[model samples]
Target: MELYNWMVEPFQTGFQIRALLGGLLAAVMSSFVGVWLVLRGMSFFGDAFVHGVVPGIAAAVLFEFSPFLGAALAALVMVSLLELIHRTTSLKEDSAIGLLFVGMMALGVVLISRSDSFQGSLTAILFGDALGVSWADVQMQLLFVIGVGLMSLMLYRPLMSLSFSPDKSQALGMRPQLTHWLLLLMIAAAVIGSFQAVGTLLVLGLLIGPAAAAALITRTVPRMILTSLILGMISVTVGLIFSYHLGTAAGASMALVAILGFFLILTIRETVAAIVRRKRSTTLVEQGAS
Candidate 1:
């Protein structure tokens, strides 16, 4: 009974329910896009892209405009700059990512510093206020979730081919470049839709952690995605419950849970594999002795 109450208590209020809905929506979209990011080895690019949108979101906060538009425009600029640097310079993609990562984050701080409520606004933008989620926010996130899901499904073959062999994708007429751009767009959408719930800095946790954890035990992409969705939801639920009981920041709690969950899954998987190896070795020795 106490355990049941503990599970039910955090979501007793309207704001709490909204927070759960928002987090779930964020998880759904992030999971759909995140699997591909992991497969394509673009985790660094995804991190930079998340930070890349901060200036736009900060500007929107200061100028009283829609954050979604600001984030979208910033995403376009980030990708364009990344592509230009790759095409025009001898520097590697990682180098370009590092440059934009620092530059965009610093720019965001500078922009946020201009606000009258600089500290408050910055905190909210960086850490998020999970309890402050509104129904309107939930509605917007739902649309993003649907769009991401559809795109992910549509581009699965191209993305899979690109991940394994870009040359093969090109040979197959998959248009690897266009598929790559669409994946970037999906990542941006997930980050933009989720930042309000988990913040841009922390949204990467949900974006990567769940999918990474799922990768540990799952071999197939479909199973990995399903496992990631389950893990993401668990992280959100457990994080919120802990936040309510322990007086923690909801978004930070959730992000932390997602990351910790990854390590836990890793530990368990490794331990199980070791035990199995040991058992097999022991059995072989016994058979040899006999």
Candidate 2:
């Protein structure tokens, strides 16, 4: 009907199909990684990575290379720098993260202003408009998502162990150091994959919102991850539809809606629990009176 036509019309050409697929893939990949980021108390790091990638992404754009790879490498460099600073000095993780992120982001802005395609390149990289996606974009997202997914799946043991307790994991011969870097690499990959759909700015919604919401509603890591994926997809689909119809920013709308959905779920759960508690109290009162 009308809705079907709207959806199909945009995708009648291959370009739109790629855009759609890229977005969907980003949702899946980001949601999974977001869970870990939320659980590890490293939410800010993801945001930092988003900001920190500006210079690398800008450089890659100028060199006509893969901007996503450039962005990932840049983030890894920042992580390494943070680790070095933390180890070499008394600086806390938060302090280190703040210093590196701000410095790199400022440098990026300066470099970006010099590049002719800076605005356009950054717009696409930071907030995938979905309107500008090509087949190549879709292919890149697919490959990254699949590669990262398989990698994470295989390393689940070490990652989970490390997340629980690096000391314990290391004591148990798990190579916590190796696992730590691998987890960061996974996060970098997640952020890179989401660069086109959610953009670097809003992609954290995938890396944080879904996971936080899932955590609020679940007790186990696996359950949280599954819930995060579902919530992330819901955010993506709803945001896309609203953006398409209302002429709003798709990535922003999606992030807002996803966050709203988290609160909505919380409200509903609270209300239901309250009602159940009231009923239980009333039943107890009646029984005691009898």
Candidate 3:
């Protein structure tokens, strides 16, 4: 009975329910797009992409426009600049990413600082207000989930081929370049859709944590994606429960849970593997003695 009440207590209010729904939607979309980011070794790109949209979101907040549009435009600008630098300069992609990451993040701070409610707006954008999620936010996130999920499914083969071999993907007429752009768009969408729920900085936890954890436990992409979704949902639920009982910030709690889950699974996996190796070595020594 105590356990049941502990689980049910968080959802006793309307705002809490909305928060859960928004988080779940964010998780779904992040998992769908995050797997590709991990597979392509674009974790750095993912980090930069999230930060890249901050200026747009900050501008939207200051100018009284839709954040989604601002984020989308910012995403486009970031990608375009990245590509331009890559094509026009001798610097590596990482350099471009680093440049934009710092530039955009700094610009966002500058823009937000100009706001009348500077501290409040900055805090909300960076850390999020999970319990303050609205039904409209949930609705928008649902659309993102559906769009990202379907696009991920559609681009699976192309993305897989590209991850393993861009040359082969291109030779196979898979259009690796187009697929790469689409993946970027998906990542941007995931980040934009989720930032309101988890905040821009913390959203990276959901975007990479579950997928990275799943990669350790699952072999195939499909299995990894499935595992990531399950783990992501579990993190959200556990985080919300902890937030309710401990009076912690819900979004931070959820993001922290996702990140901690990855380390916990990694530790357990390594421990078990070590134990297995020790047992195998013992067996080999016994056989030699016999």
**Alpha-carbon lDDT, every model:** 0.93, 0.80, 0.92
lDDT of 3 by residue, 116-232 (tens): 999999888888878889999999998999999999999989999998899999999999999999999899889889988899988888989999999999989999999999999
Residues 1-290 of candidate 1 have per-residue lDDT tens digits of 99999999999999999999988888888899888899889999999999999999999999999999989988898899999999999999999999999999899999999999999889888888889999999999999999999999999899989998999999999999999989988998999999989899888999999999999989899999999999999998999999999999999999999999999999999999999999999999999999
Order the candidates by lDDT, highest first — what do you get? 1, 3, 2
Which residue pairs in candidate 2 collide? 34-207, 126-199
Off by over 4 Å in 2: 1-13
Residue 145 in candidate 1, Cα distance off native in Å: 0.5
- Backbone clashes per model, in order? 0, 2, 0
Return the TM-score for candidate 2, rounded to 2 decimals: 0.91
RMSD to the hidden true structure, all candidates: 0.7, 2.2, 0.9
Q: What TM-score would you give candidate 3 relative to the actual structure?
A: 0.98
Over the full model, what C-alpha lDDT does candidate 3 score relative to the true structure?
Answer: 0.92
- The prediction achieving the highest TM-score against the true structure is 1
Clashing pairs in 3: none
